[model samples]
Target: MQTQDRTNVSSVEAAIAASQNYLLSIQYPDGYWWVELESNVTMMAEVVLLHKVWGTDKTRPLHKAETYLRREQRSHGGWELFYGDGGNLSTSVEAYMALKLLGVPETDRAMKNARDFILERGGISKTRIFTKFHLALIGCYSWRGIPSIPPWIMLLPESFPFTIYEMSSWARSSTVPLLIVFDRKPVFITDPAITLDELYAEGAGNVKFELPRSSDWTDLFVILDDAFKLAENLNLVPFRQEGLKAAEKWVLERQEETGDWGGIIPAMLNSLLGLRCLDYDVADPIVERGLQALDRFAIETEDTYRMQPCVSPVWDTALVMRSLVDSGMTPNHPALVRGGEWLLDKQILDYGDWAVKNKQGKPGAWAFEFVNRFYPDVDDSAVVVMALNGVQLPNEKLKQAAIARTVAWIATMQCQGGGWAAFDLNNNADWLNLLPYADLKAMIDPNTADVTARVLEMLGSGNLSIDNHSLSRALDYLKNEQEPEGCWFGRWGVNYIYGTSGVLAALSLVAPQSHGNNIDRGAAWLVSCQNPDGGWGETCFSYDNPALKGQGNSTASQTAWAIIGLIAAGEGTGKFEKDAIDRGINYLLATQQSDGTWDEAYFTGTGFPGHFYLKYHLYQQHFPLTALGRYQAIFSK
Candidate 1:
């Protein structure tokens, strides 16, 4: 057993060496880099795109990831949020497709297992909305069962309650291809392994296909059993033609000259596929340019390589910059200037979906990336302001303008109660969560503690309006949201610890004069929540299980978030905070591979609080820097 363990460790080391070299080559010329973003459905798109681009999918990482994914298949043969978990229908459908592309035969054990699971889970008839739509495209399911995304919504003025602009940033980007697909009803591929007869509902054959109408329910989405009723009528000739033209034009115009939508595989694939259905030739410049752009997102790491769904240079750079400055890296260091420039170049100058949806004047808000014009998130905006304030930009006018615009944007986004939502103001209705078959708990509106706290603190410190009556109402909401024990629940991050730390940090920035009152209370709560191992960790599962509160093995990343929060709350050198920081740094130091990175199988960030977690490759590096920087800058003295 000892010898086998040694062999396994050697193999991992070899693979890591190769992967590191490959990663190094892929770094952007600008000194920072990004990989594709991914989720269950989009992951498959990346797999297919990678295979097509590279002409061979044989890589050490691909094999390892494939093995992990297959091993994670549930007893019935489907994959979930984590590998070897129970199936999420959409994710399972995508995974099954990926395996097939990888040459897994229908009779293969993994494939058979997945098929059986799909059958038992009410078959494709009961699949989630997006899953059913994709299956219908390939003839595995019927198009009639899917809801419609009307192009007419585009024509709706910005003032309308349910304008397409009101959809989540993610939803709007996703909705574009959906609108195209809905209008054309393009079912281009049919799988012999699965068919409509194998999955459709009984006695539902021969019903004419209809599209789902759009509705805005500011209330909450609650699950309902009845089938979605078709809208009373359709606008036949003129409206249908108008919708079709708009859909086609939208798809073509948004095709990045490079062919990727923010360099994501699914959006690129679906849009290109729709264009093909419209008779665009494969050799057309639109298609050719897209293919070239998609190729750039792939990284050939060590023994294997895969495409990242999108780049995250700005996001990673911003966080790392803070970590360095906080860690005691002098402000004059060249790294700070290079990183600050990258961030300065990332701010959105034009109005985005926020402008259309909220009818707010076009104020600057930083988005996740440059080209994602749909929704400029409030959290990113708040953090950008904080990051910008840390480094001095050479251009004085530009710096002042950025500060003023960011301040204005954040102040407007603050809810009537003083907190901020992720994407919009006054849009946190739970009704979106009740999309009958959708299992995502994160689809609801964002009161998101971390985001709200960050916004309050950023605006408050600078003589901004984050302290207005509306801002105070937000603070009251945060206070009430806090558990009697003093911890608040994190909506976009992990569990109670994330919320507790965020609230502490924001309250400190707001009430710094109170000097350790709210800060002390928040600090006490965090100290109490610290695990015996001295580092902080919270499982994504904690969202579903309050009893599992603060229950996770020690991790460097969460420990850093917690430690930073505590320090920001004025507890920098407190016993528990210091202990947590020391242990977390030690954990990171011990785990660092020779390549100056750490591999954590546990996902520390949340996209959907109860349903999905993100594996941020840079978190282990940047976060440790932040925590360590804080220790050096303050405690070392």
Candidate 2:
């Protein structure tokens, strides 16, 4: 028994070392790590349609994009928003249309299957509103079918109830330019041959377009939408001129020096479309720089090409740096110092959109992307501060200064219920979602368990405690949020396991002995959900069906999350918890590839819950390392 225990220790230590070396080797000289944030084919499908709209289809490597789209097609012939999910109507429409534009024949096997699948699901008319918007730009879909987003909203005073400032930061940035495009309703005529006429099931002329009436408020908004369209057809909008000017100016001014907007693809692509509507010369510097920025988001290889939903160098670096240090890398190692120093330089000292609501909060913290200065989110800011906690930097004062203001800034961002959101402070106007244009239901930044738990973890890692004045209410929030079965909801990750792990970790650090009950219940729930194979998993379907929580095929990241959660809940003393942790750690060890990475084909990251998902290419890399390192720290002691 003693020899076996010794072997286990040696194995854990060896796994940690291999992961550390692998991550260290990949660190850029300037000090950061990044990888693709894969979402779905629609991202690249839009890229194809965007170039075709602007007549630059020949300029980019469209063939490479075509290759990627074909590779992602499901066995049934349509595309999905994430892996292993059935075909999504909107995604399939976009991919089919894009493939046709790239000259795929209707008679081809791939095209026939996609067309059959789409038509079986009610054709293009059944697709989402966003896909309709993309089709409208190329004249394949009617502008009349598209929902109205009055540009006049841009001219409203900030104090008004419906001002742009009320929307979430990402929604606001992406929508302002869209307001201009919706008003102009421009259609750049595409090649006569490049039409989606055959994809419309009801025939393009006969399809009825309607907004979903999920509530009485939405029903009223749908009627109002008709009124707005009638007014639009009559050119009766009062502030159309002023509205256009304000929106155009807002879009241009918000473009970062790096030429991206909102640091995401939607904003970048829509800004390009907005510029086209305004008659900007294609060769203009702003247009050229924006083009270059979008080009940088694309990753091409010998056979396939794809675009990331967004880049995450700062987010990835902060997490990876912390994971490496936790794995026993020396605090002052060159990798840690360089990565820490690089993060210090990325701090946003100037005010951003969050400042509009959190006026008392000073600007300090980092954003997920390389240069999205206007939107530094609380989630990323918290993790980055925690990541820098013990790292030794040459300019120690600089690190302290950044963390202090960040801590202060994060404090002021607490919502009404003592929870934190990613971007805005108290951005919980749920009624805004009733608007027809908010079909995605992502207009408001509501406080979520995953984010609040992460915030608590950051607080617990520092001077704050459960009884601290700043966190007493937050602790209550977490306590009340626990489900009857003991798991918590993960609004930003896959269902229950992610939320439970984060909350248990926070409780382990911040809660006193009196709080052990909450920890035990959560830890027990996690133990009960373990798969027969000894790992843990959850499906995105849980967002749509609560009963499905903590059920799916196990993957590297989710299993690591469960292990980290159990350890945080004091697993070592309990036979059940200890065995569960042992099995999980062993699963990670057995599944890790020879290159010190794990292959995760399933997406553990969440975009908009059920509607969208993401597979962070590095989630398989950094998370397991953190799990193993933290486990060694506790049991090996």
Candidate 3:
């Protein structure tokens, strides 16, 4: 047993050394880390549309992007939102249209196969609202076929049922500009060669836009949608001009100095197109700035190019800094100091939309993007505070002030259910999801267990204790939110493992004595769900189906999450815990690359539940290192 313990200790130490060195090697000169955030082929398709709308002859780049899209097509001839998932209808339609515009013939085998798959899945008519809107812009689908999203939504007051403040930051940022495009209904007349008629099914013409009557409240929203359409047709919308001006002002105000709106592809693209529709010349400084900002998202290779969904330097740096410190790096190490300084500079000291619902807290939160001051998120703020607290900075007084302000701000963002959302405080309005334009399924900013647990962990890391009212309420919320099978839903990460890990870690630090049973159950669940290879993985499909939770091929990141959760659950003395940790550590050691980092191709981050996903390239490196570090600290001692 002593010999076995020695082996385990050596294995963990080696992994920690390799991982730490690799992480340090990748740090930016400014002390940040950002890896490519990979998504579906839809980004490629959108780039094609952006070029076509602006009448640019970037054919060489377009052809390269088309090549990337074709390369990603599954055997079924369609693109999935993520790897190892079934083909998606909206992704397929958009890809087909983009390829057709790139001059791929209808008789091409790939195009023919894609057409068949789309037709069987109910054709272009069944695609998501965003895809339909894109088609409408190109004069393929009629604007009437798309849902009504008038600029007048901006005019609604806070007391109104559905105001701009009610939408999630991502949705709100994108919608503000989309309202302009929808009102203007701009159609850039492309060459006669570019048309989507060949991609649609025979009976697509008969398809009509109708409100989904998923429930009575939904039925009412449908009626409201119809009313809005009537008002639009008859020019009866109240404050129409005022609403348009307000929306334009809103969009212009949020456009980041980087030129992108909110630093996201959708918002950036929509804002550009919206400005164009409003008769802002292409040479307008804002339009020019927007074009320049988009150039940053594109990655051009010799043969193909891909666009990032968004940059994540701020978020990545915070996580990496935490991992490095947790892995036994000194708090005042040069890298640590640089990261701390960088994060301190990124802190938002001005009010954002989150203030609408949370008017009391002073601004000290952090945004995921470098320049999205109008929309700082609670999750990023918590992580940044935790990192700032962990590191020893030269300006200790300033760091403490930043931490205190962030903690206060996060407390204000807590909802009635004692949980925290990503961006807004209490932006939950389920009825709004019933709107026809909400096919993306991310309408409101409801509190989630994963984010709430993260906040708890952050608070616990600081001077806050379990006796604090905010921490106590959050504990109760987490207890009630746990699944019967003993895992929590991961709203931002892959699935149950991520949530369970986050909750267990936070509880261990904040309320360990009171959560014995919860911790044990979560530990048992993690042990039972371990893959045969001694690692762990969870599919994004788990978001849509609960039974699939904690089920998939083993991955480095998910496996690390499980190991860390078990360690936090007081599995120090148990045989199962000992065995599980041993196996998990060996798996990491076996999988580590020559450069000391692990390779992961799977999509582990959640964007909009079932509709969108993300692959944070740095996740594989930082998380596994943290897990190994924690294991060594407890067992090696």
Candidate 4:
């Protein structure tokens, strides 16, 4: 080998060794990776609201959460949906209300600033539906002014244009109990000083719920909401008691073994409050179990406590397993075996909400959370399959069975558009997004380029030919979805880099011959976006404005993603690509801490485009490890 090749190999080997040791050191004895899932101050504030409504004496925790919120407050005087984001109306409104309820006086300067920020953003009335619901619990906002989300919607037939099942699993879990809350209209017992009248742009009495413009389907939902309100006022609703009972039953049935509903905070909290409204005593087993489950989501430090949006053991463990294997770990390595066994235990054999839209598919996917059987996402399933496929276990039959089932299930989940969605199939009822209760913008689970690419990658890893019908359709979908600038939209990650990287990587593996020019275009786009510092980063702002794609401070995870994408596109064979990969690898090496992990404070995970984001603390470590390992395997030859 040339001296330059020898040096590159040595550098790659050293980086991989250090990163592998770090990853292994952090692995749990049971062989799963559970990283900190961080979101915004909204989680802490919502926890405060949860305790206040449940009448729990969580004084100390509430105080700590209040402190955390204050500490996180941006210099602009309001909280944001994600770290480093500008002040958000809903998050700011909720934080202000939570602090006030915790006895922070309105006269306090911080409180005054927050209040000013709220008013400047059109005040409390302009907050999202969930925020409005929380405010109404404390009597700060009139429940009537919020969009109607009657529990009666649950009684709609499956054939109906809109039903609970038509919503995304997270939305379904949250909305079921929320509908019950809407019915009971429970008020928070608090001192009069806790009211938010002072934060209102206009007097509280002037607040009104107005219909949306009649230019689109949102207007129809708005009209339906008004009609529901009229029905509610006249007590002319049909089967009201039966609807409540059915909603309650649905919530109870979906309660996870871990006591969480779908293993998400919004559903867990909503289910608890809904049960309380149904007159279930605080000591009731269901309520007690629910509270206990929620307690697990709390991440407490010496002086602060914050709530995670959700746990991600299944997702994290699977990705780590793949990274370890890619970094040269053997298939029968103990860590791989243990991790593979743990993942096999997590597969969902029973059907879930995804089955509602895709009845033809069998039950064999995995959920993102530890016990959210009702919502096994396609992204998690694909990655898990990839991880399991890399491991050689003692029980060969069990491993093969798991892989076959997962592959078949993923195939069944293909959308009509020749792609795949995260949770459900054929769930792209765009008109449903106009519903008054769809303020979170997650009502529909539509096919996305990132997820479809991941599915294609999984199929390729399993040795499915590009000529297969499913693979062929997926290729078509990706080709049609590629943007004018040679990128794709990342639905679950940050932005164009994520989407383009994912698509390029999958095409390189599954449809190399067909996607040669496509890969070239994607590779060129990635190279063009490289930052001056030799690393790549895309901001959360890209979700709102495509112009910001691939434009931000360099981050270890995004840089690694760009590197992996480029390598997959055969850029490693070119001088420019080789330099880019070396620089990106060097960036990872230089940024490594004494403990061997890379530091990443930026949010890369997306909860909702532009509205919510997440920071998976492990992404910085595992992704770079995977990228470096792949680099070594490709070019170290």
In the range 1-637, model 4's lDDT, one tens digit per residue, is: 9897788688778878888898888889887889899988788788788787777746336677778888988888899887677789899988888788888888998998988888998898778878888888888877776777777778899888877777777777888887778877777676533778887787776867563455865577777778988988898878888889999999999887778898889888888888978989878888888888888999888878889999999999999989989989999999889899999998999988878778788998899988887889889999998998888999989988888888888888888999999988888777667667776777888899999999888877778533477778889999999887888889988878889889988988877877777888888888889888889999999988888878888899999999988988884224237777778878887787777688977898899897789999999999999998888887776
In order, candidate lDDTs are: 0.61, 0.86, 0.85, 0.84
Instruction: Name the top TM-score candidate.
Output: 2
**Which candidate leads the pack in lDDT?**
2
Off by over 4 Å in 1: 1-42, 45-78, 83-89, 116-126, 190-238, 250-270, 273-277, 291-293, 301-307, 436-445, 460-467, 513-518, 572-596
lDDT of 3 by residue, 177-241 (tens): 88889888877886534677755665656656454457655677667778888988898878788
Which scores better on lDDT, 1 or 4? 4
Candidate 2 achieves a global lDDT of: 0.86
Tell me how far the alpha carbon of residue 267 in candidate 1 is from the true structure, in angstroms, after superposition. 4.4
lDDT of 3: 0.85
For model 4, the superposed segments whose C-alpha errors exceed 4 Å read: 1-7, 191-193, 209-217, 465-467, 571-576
Better of 2 and 3 by lDDT: 2
Error of 3 at 309 (Å): 1.2
- Enumerate clash totals for all models, in the order shown: 31, 0, 0, 0
Residue 385's lDDT within candidate 3 is: 86
Instruction: Say which prediction, candidate 2 or candidate 4, comes out ahead on TM-score.
Output: 2
- For all predicted structures, in order, the TM-scores are 0.79, 0.97, 0.96, 0.96
True-structure lDDT of candidate 1: 0.61
